[model samples]
Target chain A: MQKADALVPVSAYVARAALGRLAAEGSVKVSETEPDWAALVIRVRDHGDTQAFAALFRHFAPRVKAFLMKSGAGAALAEECAQDVMATLWQKAHLFDPARASVATWVFTIARNRRIDTLRKARRPEPEDLPWGPEPEPDQADAFELAEDTRRLGEALAQLPEKQRALIERAYFGDLSHTEIAAETGLPLGTIKSRIRLALDRLRQSMT
Target chain B: MTIRHHLTDALLMAYSAGQLPEAFSLVAATHISLCDECRARLSAFDAVGGTLIEDCDPAAMDEDSLTATLARLTGAPARPRQVDRPARGLFPAPLRDYVGGDLAAVKWRPVGLGVRQAILPTAPGGVARLLYIPAGQAVPDHGHRGTELTLVLQGAFRDESDRFGPGDLEVADQGVEHTPVAEADADCICLAATDAPLRFNSLLPRLAQPFLRM
Candidate 1:
């Protein structure tokens, strides 16, 4: 069998195992392909896979660093955050479960939280002085294969009314919550939440 | 659920971007979790995020950065660890559950009586922007000088033409004019995008124009 085909059965078994863990942990079930494969690899790779881990680090680390820097962190600080995020990935590799979230979603969540931490530390203000609570746990949303998944996701996103797409971007990337979104957009909060719920449902159905 | 009660397009976009306030974001996330259609839309938005990153001009990194990182990782000793503690505290657990995680770390500020606001520091050129507002206060009646996009994050409000709630997106032409008043019991929050400043109708509003570029 081709190397890819040869890996299928093992991948399937690993995916099932990971899913079991995720189900026990109360995370979302993996319903997509790339996440399933990546989860399998994560479960099987021993700590000795330094080279492979390094490759993952190389691809993701810079991106994480860039994201932080773009969001206002200094280069050095961004690098530190990125390093910490990758380190978390290395230490928590065993936790990767396709049933819970996609690889990109997981990685991005790590970066997102790290960025939040960095932001918190940059301030001289104490914990009591903080207005909002700490960041939420990263979503275990399903990950898609980079090439095809991205293409399909894009198509689906484009299919949404332009208004919906804009709101999702603000929510996911802009970090504005529903109330803030209402104030900024001059819309009712109920209307905003309803649209987001509908849009998310549509996107999920489309992907499946 | 009344389909009409569903979030508007603009609100959904904002929710996907993480731009809504905590109170309203929770509601949107909860609804999305139960609603497969919204989840699919959110996935599509994530794809768009991926595309934006792919399209963004790559910032130049030091030539040795990769090498330095690799060397450090290789030399680091392996240590047993648990997955990091899940985020808690900032928002109520019920709201956090619906958001697919990630609802803390935003900067919130009081914008008016009974209202607080926060600006999400994402996107470089200010082409995309996010803002949060609290309940009951009325955003002064105003019109956009250019195309403006707004998404409700939390609570509910009524403009002249319609009522909006969490996850609703409203795109206004330059000619649009209205005042958003929050619902009696809840605060209103939103994410808005505009090319130019808002045009106010009165003296106080005109005075505020310089301070509020929205």
Candidate 2:
């Protein structure tokens, strides 16, 4: 009886894995209503389309400024840094990998690096780039699913208890040290972590 | 190479948040360069950062900010997409960049025993160094005052708890004390970072600690 019970969960997990693979291969239709943040970046990269860049700037620049301000920059400095961050976004559009990260994630990384450079004056060593997939054109399904995953992650963050949510916000805002983060409230990171893991697995599959 | 141990979630989160000291960031970056698991995990934390940024209350930019940014973008060229290399040498790219090249680039100074170390330049509040332990040699026994992160770059080492091979990271804290010995077959090279000075158990190493900065 115990053997049967174990087999049931194993089979279910296998089924789920297969379904995920099928979805990643573009068999499943992602809703068309979902915003295609990658498309704007592609326009900026390939055509230097100011309209597309303007759209991205209008959405992300203010948030980037807010992020810098929270990290201890004065208003004028935050404004200047936010502009620099957006200008960098325009110049580094080619480096953005939609299949690997959502637009917001890419923008956040760029902003975070700028904050470090301007605020801390410290070097941030980045991981070596993994050899991307042989496909020159990113698969639309992969990009869509990754964006959707990040959107869901934002929702999950919103649903966490106030204390846990605040802790997470503080960590990102540069207020918490690793030791303090570890000692503080137990963040319910499992859901978001697993969701991101799923996105990574899809990208890894596409890479190979 | 198979990696057994990995960075803790707290470390990865701090790194993604850009809150870690530069020395620890160097160690974390070098380890992530070698370990794909941590790379994926780091991306997860970055995604959390993205979510936080998205949910932030907007602090409106000056009305001319977008126009000013676009003006700056007119003459600037986008950086060419980085081409991926097929194979890597002993040190990953981050460590290589720090050292200016591969294994040949490091300037080693003896720190007692057969071990040698070269401190990497980073901002204050922590220290990062490359450690070389001769085959079958033992590093001085030490306990951590804060956190100590050691990542194997080449060969393997065995401490009181377990073995660490290339790409493995051991995160030791204040509560732990151990002497790590290089495996007999090959010399071991590692990147280690600590926020506070290590507590050396032996008097000789203790005396030399200030000069060596370990």
Candidate 3:
């Protein structure tokens, strides 16, 4: 089932038509002349567009699977986690806002949350009546522009002091908190926080 | 701003990497939204994380795995709506800023008068190490059954070897056994990661074990 009208790339047109057909089936609604495709996807998601959701899933599913596998999840668990993340994207598409984050960022966030949830569930008994946090508001910016900002971000992070970098890595990648990091590195928690703060401030300055 | 009130860099790093608890991450995200300085820093850290992920050798995947995954997605049923929310108001800026927003998300169940324990969820199939100590009190004389790592988030705690302040990390092997008393005027908040459980000499703490996950 293909529609033949090409103002943009054929793939884009195909994707658009597919999404439109899905919407016709009461899965999503797509408007013509929407400048921001990512925002459109988000809107479709908010409206519970299953086809749009499916397309998004098709795009990110492999990457999510790869990410989980790399993060030390076994094959079965990674597959389960990847599936869970895609399902979440469909279920929570309405929560996404293109201005606040990129499609990748949003999708990755869903993946991250799912991974964390899976981990938590596998560990302790589920807590009763846990509170949910508020959703972040969207920013009014183009997603493409954020790429440049993120590029500079990479440079800034690379320039952090070696100790700061190590501490940051341990905390972020190793998943250790400030106290745990201090214990691991034998540094003061204040020092760890200060180093991170200084590093962040410097990075911000450099990016600006 | 009081340095002790802000979250430590390490914790911020963890938050950026999606390693912090959801509750704390929520606070950190809100803080970063308001604090451009922290946001930029977090972005940089995230960049580093991206780089690490890229540089890490992608362990080989099973043959035709991508094809199988694609099929699974196409065949999979649409996901139902489910919202997984973090705790609310649990981490106001005051506490979040002090501990880098990570500790603020834990469900602190009181262990004793002024003493509380929060057992953070570890990675899947990972160890179940818990943080134990008084909220604003001193940690009793104790030793580790396995390697223990401690990082002070707020206030000060003095052990036999040194006094730990905010952002300080103490790596203790099994040989070290000491009591850490919080400064009388300040509350002691620390994040601890251990491979094995703590062995408290006192009967009271041992009795509290069933209730406490640490």
Candidate 4:
């Protein structure tokens, strides 16, 4: 059914519904969707909830497109990549496990990996270089631990000094290498390294 | 796994930010799969990546993008829900894809006395490979011209800095040099990546360097 989805010039969501039906046609059982976006993903998986899938696409697609553009993809390529990524999210919704990561985290990881895959395809000729299928969930036993980390992560990021936070933003979102950042900020390379190290140490301490 | 050595905070941050080269990414992803602590650290970074993306200046998508995507989703194929209960091997799925199965399937060639290596097909400007060293064997003494990431898959190896065992990573830069000798009683295996050629100490290793592709 997935192979079929790739061929049709029609809408990808329609393709997904057909895929969902193909799955249901089998002997497998469908589960109920949860309350949040992550659960909505489950709905898209188990029942082909077009409404749920619509909500997710509306929320993530623009952000994903922008993210790719910042990561060096041209505007046209970013649009194309975002479309495919959202389609993959629907097709692979069954792989979602709320116990491991929140919906945003899961989606962003896919976005990040997908960008890498696209960039690599142009430069390298290897097919298997595409990371992996989907990630295995983090240990469920670490939920409490992960929650604490998540909570502290926000607080810790906010607590960073303004200058360090600026550096972090450039490093994280601007997708700048140390050299690029150093040039942009007009700071010495040593200064950039020290600031990043200090910020990471703070984050590490807060989480652990 | 109790990994004694690890990728530096800087490298992990680069990996999390999607700025690391392809080979270095393989090292980070493989080690992250084996070590929960590092994996957790990386996930935290991803959360930060999420917030950063959301805060980015919004790009205006096409009017039909959403409607088109939704239409495509309808025919999306269903992926199987059953995940591997315990993730059945030492290597992660990415590594297995490159090596084409598990440890036994690897086609290793001799690099030195009791040392074997198989170079992976990585993007240009970086070289990635699998190295298997028999117990008590020592890799040649060398300093790095660029970054070298060595993530141990099995057994242990000790260098001038410290000991590295399974899931442990040694991130070497231009300033570092050492002889890595595998632990006794068990062979050591690693997924290593290098951005530049090594600076070997002696003539013999240098003579063999071209053949080893180091």
Candidate 5:
């Protein structure tokens, strides 16, 4: 079988998470509300829960700001972008489907796309379909699976070989394409692609 | 349809990071809608993106930013969003938004050799179009000057590399060259995007390129 074909069963994933190396930290952790963030966001939407919204903002805003800064945004612009992301969350809270996306994925996707939108000087109308795109069929990552996957992602990422992990950050966060990464790092295109593929395999193995 | 061809991890990562042009992202998004596996994997990539954000060196924000955001929230009523669920048809949500309607509504202009095309208006310099090929028909043999994402929305097509069925996305670049022929059973409809013009091998196709605007 190809290396990429080694997708683990859910039991293996559970075993991996139970080992504690799999629980990754992030911007927010809901101690009182715990894992059901979809419900928490729903509370923010239905009842206008200030506490939940505030909690989300406090944890994510600084990180979103930092994210934009990494993508070469000025401090002032990054802050504005971060604020826009938070406002979008509040405004679009009803669209949060926990089954389809973890809170971390949903928030960061907003941050990533917002960075691009702000960078574009022209203000064009975005199609009804937002950046996250559509999720029609049921995904394999159920809420329980997503909770485990999100908790474990950081740990799995941390365990990657230094070079692989760094490349992943550049690819996912720095907004660099594989070819661009090769150019920046002075690595061959083939080398960068293979390293990233291997890194993703490890992440999938460790995440699953 | 069993999806055999898929966007490479590198391509998928580029799409997730917004490094790809809008045209490439549009094709990726449309294929992702129909392929549950790709959607699931993309979610993982998105989560990874979120983790990277948390790990960045903290950038200080405006002290009054939180105060401002909070103050604005109280005045702004909760905006309920009506998600536009694309009707179950040949066109998915992303494609529907560009086409402005269902598949039959497409205004296809001839692209020679029984192939029809409707170029969707997107950001300048990035070209995305819908292709219709009758069964057993073939796209002119060609390579790409830049990246091309060909997503099969209906039926199947085969190139030099492999066969692609519904929900399969073929990511092509300059180094790859092949003729993609639709399967015999049904006509093929694909959403394709290319950043640069194609490199057709034949003299006639190459000569006609300026006219096709491909």
Candidate 6:
């Protein structure tokens, strides 16, 4: 683990509030009208809520499949791998730290590791997990802020000029090696990097 | 120990994108295990991937995709969270996974001049190894053809470029050439990875290079 900061004190009050929300909406549905992904993951984590898992699967599975295909997997393999990624997601929901990563970000990591296994037949070494303390849930404000930051980052990525955006996409989509990425000239990655950097600082502060 | 040296954004981004060779990924993971700055930077890069996935054009799944996936989830349960262990030993978790234990478990082979190395298994394209340099001994003068990552784990070393202490990572490429000597205070143990064979400047090491598998 990295540096230990002040612990996030467990709050039974917040825990009951979360359970209250889950109880109030006895049968949740996947809808454009309600897309609180972190809350939905909490529902899945606390109670094995199939409705919430179904909603997450509906939203992320196809995107994961598309992500795999872009990395050069055939459609069938991509579909199979995407399902595995989602299954791993459900199995690892307790490990998801909404204060640290968006659900989309967490899903990307799962899909990326799956691609490494199925496509390249290689291992992906990961950093040690931070000890996130006894609380599985985070401060609601922290989770909400992280989601907002993720949304803003998506918009920023979309607004980049065509060439810059394409280069960035190519870098993430396995089109560029580290050497090529290092030698890439005039990349417009500075602004995007700073935006994400700020989000990380906020996350670190919230963890403290 | 505080780490002064860190991985470049290029390497971190490539790692975040899952594009590095296995050897390079191993070095990066070990360094991130020891360095928080790089860890935070890596998370930011992962955010970039997240954004890309979010904005990508959606491909429709088969009609039964969600149902099929739900059925697969039937007997699944959340993985039990790892028990929080206090950081206890020299090796971080990632390296421990490869070595299967801490410092006492490494199987070392003598290279020459009181230096030993142990190569870890990884997919081809690069090689990852642990190098042991006795206190006050120097590795042969050499240069690299491709990228080389050397991370200090147990002791300290210095070259013409800079001093690398525990958790410090030195990323050397084609233009960097130097001899690294272990500090006299203690024996130095490092985890090093190279993409291409090193170009030893002297005849003896050059001849021994093939057997060294460096």
Can you write out model 6's per-residue Cα lDDT over B143-192, one digit (the tens) per residue? 45788899999889999979999999999887777889999999999999
TM-score of 2: 0.83
True contacts kept of 5: 0.38
lDDT score, candidate 2, position B122: 80
Writing each residue's lDDT as its tens digit, candidate 2 over B146-187 gives: 889999998899998899999999999877868899999999
Model 1 / residue A88 / CA error / Å: 3.3
The alpha-carbon lDDT assigned to residue A166 of candidate 1 equals 64
Model 4 Cα RMSD, 1 decimal: 11.5
List the per-model TM-score of the A chain: 0.49, 0.73, 0.47, 0.54, 0.60, 0.73
- Model 5 clash count equals 3
- The numbered model that scores best in DockQ is 6
For all the predictions, what are the DockQ values? 0.11, 0.27, 0.11, 0.20, 0.19, 0.29
CA lDDT of each prediction against the hidden true structure: 0.49, 0.79, 0.49, 0.66, 0.67, 0.77
How does candidate 4 score on lDDT? 0.66
- Model 5 CA deviation exceeding 4 Å by range: A1-42, A121-145, A178-208, B74-87, B197-214
Per-residue alpha-carbon lDDT of model 4 for A30-74, expressed as tens digits? 454423676577777777666677667766788889888877788
Docking band of candidate 5:
incorrect
Instruction: Provide the interface RMSD of candidate 1 in angstroms, 1 decimal place.
Output: 9.9
Q: Least lDDT summed over 10 consecutive residues: which range in candidate 3 chain B? A: B122-131
Question: By summed lDDT, which 10 consecutive residues of candidate 3 chain A come out lowest?
Answer: A123-132
| Candidate 3 residue lDDT tens string, B125-152 | 1132224454457785444565455656
* Cα lDDT of model 5 by residue, B100-158, tens digit: 88998899998788899999887643578899999999986534577778999989998
Among the numbered candidates, top lDDT falls to: 2
What lDDT score goes with residue A144 in model 5? 56
Which consecutive 10 residues in model 5 chain A have the weakest lDDT in total? A1-10
lDDT of 4 by residue, B1-214 (tens): 6877776667666777666767777788787666555664555566676655655676888867776675565564485553444446767766887778788888898877878899887654467899988999997543456778899998999988789988889988756767899989899999998874533225545775697544
- Candidate 2 stretches with Cα past 4 Å from truth are A1-35, A183-208, B75-87, B198-214
B1-214 in candidate 1: lDDT tens per residue? 2222444555565544444333334445545533445554544444444444433344545555544554454433343343344554433333333323344545556555645545433222223333454566787543456545565656777889898776565556577777778777876656555542322223444665587542
lDDT of 2 by residue, A142-201 (tens): 667667677877877788899888888888888887678752324334544554556555
For model 2 chain B, where is the 10-residue window of minimal lDDT?
Answer: B196-205
